[model samples]
Target: MADQVKLHGNWLSPFSSRVIWALKLKGIPYEYVEENVADKSALLLHYNPVYKKIPVLVHSGKPICESMIILDYIDETWPENPLLPSDPFERATARFWIKFIEDKSPVLWGVFLADGEDDREKARKATLEVLQTLEERAFGDEKFFGGDEINMVDLAYGMLARWMPVIEEVVGVKLLDPDMFPRLHALAENFRQAAVIRDNLPDHDQMVPLFKIRREQLLQIAGK
Candidate 1:
C-alpha cells in the first residue's frame, strides 16, 4: 500500500500551520483534516489523549502529537528536503531556539488574553523582554533562522511572523514596532513573503474579526 499521511489541524492555529509548512516544504503530499477546536473531534482526542490538541500527524496507522514533535517526525520520515541543520551542533542550536520560543510563546498570548489595561501592560512588557532575547541571542544577521532558506526553526517561530500581527490588531497594541524590533520586523516580512507560507497563511482581515470575537468570548468566560 502507498504511504498514508494525514494532518488533523485547525486553519487558524499557528501550531497547525507549523506542521503544514514543514510538510509543504518537504513536498510531502498528505490529506488535511480540519479540526473544530472549540468542540474537538473524537478522532483528535484518540490520537492525542494527553494534550487532546490539533496538529496531529497520522502517518500510516500511527499517530503523532504536538506541533514541534510532529514536525520532527515528518522531517525524519521524509528526508528529501531537510528542515533542521545538517551539522550536529547546528541542529542542536536550532532545537534550542525552537524550545526557547515554544516556552515564551504563551507570554505573548497573555497580552491577547489579559482583561485589564494594567494586566495587558504587564504582559506586553514581558512579551517585549522575550522578543528582546530572541532578537539578541536566537537570531542574527541571517535572512532566516535557517540561514538563507526557511527551516524548522523558522516554522517553530512562525507565529512571530504571521499570527503576532493579528494578535496585535485584535488586542489594540503595537507589539512588534519597527523601530523597537527592526530585525524581527524584517524577519516577519521575509518569512511571510516566502511563497509556500504566503500562499498558505490564514487571511489577516478574516482572522481579525474572528480573533476579536474570540478575545471577547474568552474574557467573558473568565468573567473579566
Candidate 2:
C-alpha cells in the first residue's frame, strides 16, 4: 500500500507549498486536495479541530496538521532524499532557522497589511531588520540553508522568494532591494530556477490581481 497519502491545502498559501515541495523532493506519490479557506471541508475541520488550518497531511487514516510537522513526517516516512540533516547538530540548526522564519515572517506580512504612512513605515523598518539579520546570519555564505541542497530551512523561508514580490507589488514598497539584500535576491533567483519549484509554483500573474484585491480590502479595513 502507498498509505493513502493526501494533502489538504490552499493554492496561494506558502505553508501548503512547503509540504508540496518537501513531498516532491522526496518523490512521494500523494493527492492534493485543494481547500476553500472560506468554507473549509468537513474532513479538514475534523482532522484539524484546533486550528482548522490547511496543509494537513493524512496518511493511513492518521492526520498530521501544520505544514512543518507534515514536512517532518514526509522526511521520516520517505527517507530517500532526506530533508533534514542526519547529524543532530546540523538538524537542530536547520530547525532553528525554520523556526526563525516561522516566527518572523509575520512582521513582513504585517507590513504588507499595514495602512497609514507611519504604521507602514514602522512595519517596514521591522521587516527590514529581520531580513538584514537573516541575510548576514543564515545566508551569508551558504548556497542554501542546508548547503548545496534545498532543505527544510530553504523550503520554510521560500515565501521570501515568491510572495515577498507579490507583497511588494500590493504594498507598493520595495523591500527586497538587489543592493541591500543581494544575498536574498540571489537566493530567490536560485529558488525560482529549482526544477521542482519552478514547475510547481503558483502562477504569479493570476495571484497578483487577487492579492491586489486582498490588499485593498486590508487597506479599507484599516481605514486607509
Candidate 3:
C-alpha cells in the first residue's frame, strides 16, 4: 500500500500553513483534515496528545507534532525539494534561526492579543527588537534567509509574509515599516509572491473577521 499521509490543520493557522507549504514544496500528496480549533476533534487530540494542537502530521500512523518538527520530518522523508541546506554548518545555521524565530513568535502574538495600549506597545517593541535582529544579522543582503531560494528558514518565517500584515491591520499597529526594515519588508513581499506560498495562503479577507474575534476572545480572557 502507498504511504498514508494525513495533516490535521486549521486554515487560519500560520503553524498549519508552515506544514502545508513544506508539503507543497516537496510535491507530496496528503489528506488535509481541517480542525475546528475552538472545539478540537478526538483524532487531533489523539494524534497530538501532548500539545493537542493543529498542524499535526500523521505519516503512516505515526504522529508528528509542532509545525517546525513537521516541516523537518517532511523534508527528511521526501528529500526532493530539500528544505534545509546540504552542508552541515549551513543546516545548523538554518536551524538556529528557525529556533530563534519560533522562540520569539509569542511576542508577536502577544501584540495581537494585547488588551490595552500599554500592553500592545510593550509587545510590539519586543517583536520589533526580534525583527530588527533578523533584519540586521540574519538575512543581510541576501534575497532570503537561506540566500537566493526559499528553504526551511524561509518557511519558518512565512508568518511574517501573510499573517503579520493582517495582524497589523486588525490591531491598528504598524510594525513592518519599509523605512525601518526595508530588506525584511521586501522579503515579506517576495515570500508572499512565491508560487507555493501564494497559492496556499489563507484568504486575508476571510481571516480578518476570525482573527478579530479570536483577539477579542483572548483579550476578554486576559482582562478576566
Which candidate number would show the highest TM-score if scored against the true structure? 1
Return the lDDT, model 1, position 146.
Answer: 73
As for lDDT, the candidate ahead, 2 or 3, is 3
lDDT of 1 by residue, 3-111 (tens): 8899999999999999999989998889999999999999999999999999899988799999999988988988978898899999999999999988988897989
Write candidate 3's Cα lDDT for 1-224 as tens digits.
24899999999999999999999988888999999998999999988888899889999899999999888888888998799999999899999999999998898677788767797899899889988998888875777767788899999998898899899989999999899999999998888988999999998888888889888898788774
Residue 34 of model 2, lDDT score: 99
Indicate which candidate wins on lDDT. 1
Per-candidate local distance difference test: 0.90, 0.87, 0.89
The reply for model 1, stretches above 4 Å from the true place, is none
Q: Is 2 or 3 the stronger prediction by TM-score?
A: 3
Off by over 4 Å in 2: 219-224
Q: C-alpha displacement of 200 in model 3, angstroms?
A: 0.4
TM-score of each: 0.97, 0.95, 0.97
Cα lDDT for residue 19, candidate 3: 92
lDDT of 1 at 173: 90
